[model samples]
Target: MSGLRERKKERTRQALSDIAVALFLEKGFDAVSVAEVAAAAEVSKPTLFRYFPAKEDLVLHRFADHEDEPARVVAAAREAGAVPLDALRDHVLAGLERRDPVTGLNDDPRVLAFLRLLYGTPALVARMHAYQGRSEELLADALGGADPLAARLAAAQVVAVLRVLAEENVRRITAGERVEEVLPGAVAATRRAFAGLGEGLSSFC
Candidate 1:
């Protein structure tokens, strides 16, 4: 019974998000109302708020599953007795191979359209920055009980690399490059970026 309730709730949440995105894309984010989204999804406004507390969340909730991905990778690496940097690198490589949506290498038309919506909308962009800030905090915590400043610095660099890579992938795809054509360069850039992070700033003046 509990499991069935959870599945039903998941369906409701997904339906709200799907309908919200469709409407936002059809009109514009600012032009659409939360009440309209609730109406389209056949849920009460309160029910929609139960799942997404803010208007931005209607679209950004898609990223909720990945909010702590980097932190999870660091924790898993620690458990495996491996370096977190290498773990993150391998994760990016695997994601690239799979053309993961978060990696921005996915060529699906809908995904492209969604990315377009996210980048084009200032409110969504601001909200995404806030989400990344939270992600940084999670990653810093996962970096272990080190100097707090050091962990924060490392997390900042790591997250910056990821943001740059993802943005570049989106840019290339939106510019009409196929995923297959962009894959090689993406892999190479990610490897170099991670290598720089793993090596640290010892050689710098």
Candidate 2:
């Protein structure tokens, strides 16, 4: 049945992700090839590509949660007569309340090492930029018919702020700061980043 096959496919994908993470942890991501991952997961390279179009997706897919977030929040706010940017700000800051381990907030050595690898490698760094460009495109669509130029400029600025905040959190944690200690600055950055937007777009927020 389609349902049974779908479940099996999901299991295979999870297996690949798990094995890939383990391998990346053992041997740096840059050192591992798709062939090795395919061998480890007992699948062909084509099969792996069927699940993830790119090797970077194996790791950075975890970071693409916000691709549709802004659009969703904007829609919800409009439906509730809430302001767009303000709603977006609230939605974002609220999401940050969770110290997602994927955010490099935990004391796990593997996670820290992975973060180091991502920052150290030029290819991964370029991949991150490419992902950002894609995300901004999604945000542009979310902006709907708003002032086109303003919407795009606003979306780019928000994404940039978020990227900086995430990088800062990772750096602080790597420097031996606990998540709790890093929380204030992270929240403060959110507020600072949105304060102007919130005020400027008060009518829409």
Candidate 3:
């Protein structure tokens, strides 16, 4: 029953997010209101708030699944007796190979639309910084070393590198470059970014 309830709740949450995103895309993010989204999803405003505390969350929830991905990659690498930086590098390369939206290497129209929506919204952009901060903290914990400051600094650098790499990919794609045309450059940039990190953090964590 507990599991069933959680699944039902997840469905409701997804439904609300879907409705909210459709409405936002149709109109605009700032033009849409939380109350309107609640009405469209057929849920009470309070209930919608229960699932997403803020209006920005309706869109940002799309990223919730990957919020801890970096940390998970590090943890899994440690368990497999692999270098965390190498594992992270491979993980990102795999994402690019598969055109993952998180990697900003996907050219799917739906994904492009969503990225436009996310990047064009000031509120969403501001909220994303909070997400990045959390990712760095989780990665720092995963690094787990005697010098907490070093772990935190390393995590920050890693997170910033990944973020910048993804942003560059997005910039090229949004500026009319095809994903195929950008693939080689994106992969090379990712390698260079990780190589820079490896110089200092190869043995880290």
- lDDT tens digits, residue span 34-59, model 3: 99999888889999999999999999
- Each prediction's total of clashing residue pairs, residues at least 3 apart in sequence or on different chains, is 0, 4, 0
User: Which ranking of candidates, highest TM-score first?
Assistant: 3, 1, 2
Q: Can you write out model 2's per-residue Cα lDDT over 25-131, one digit (the tens) per residue?
A: 78988889999999998899999999989998787665656556666787788788877778876765665676655344554676777787776667777888888
Clashing pairs in 3: none
**TM-score, prediction 3:** 0.98
Q: Candidate 3 lDDT (Cα, whole model)?
A: 0.92
RMSD of each: 2.7, 2.6, 0.9
Model 2: which ten-residue window has the lowest total lDDT? Answer: 99-108
What lDDT score belongs to each candidate, Candidate 1 first? Answer: 0.89, 0.74, 0.92
Which pairs of residues clash in candidate 2, taking residues 3 or more apart in a chain or in different chains? 83-204, 83-205, 84-204, 84-205
Q: lDDT tens string, model 1, 1-205?
A: 9999999988888888999999999999999999999999888999889999999999998998888999999899888888788888999999999989899898899899999999889999899988999999999899856378888888888889998999999999989999999999999999999888878822210
Error of 2 at 196 (Å): 2.8
Model 1 scores a C-alpha lDDT of: 0.89
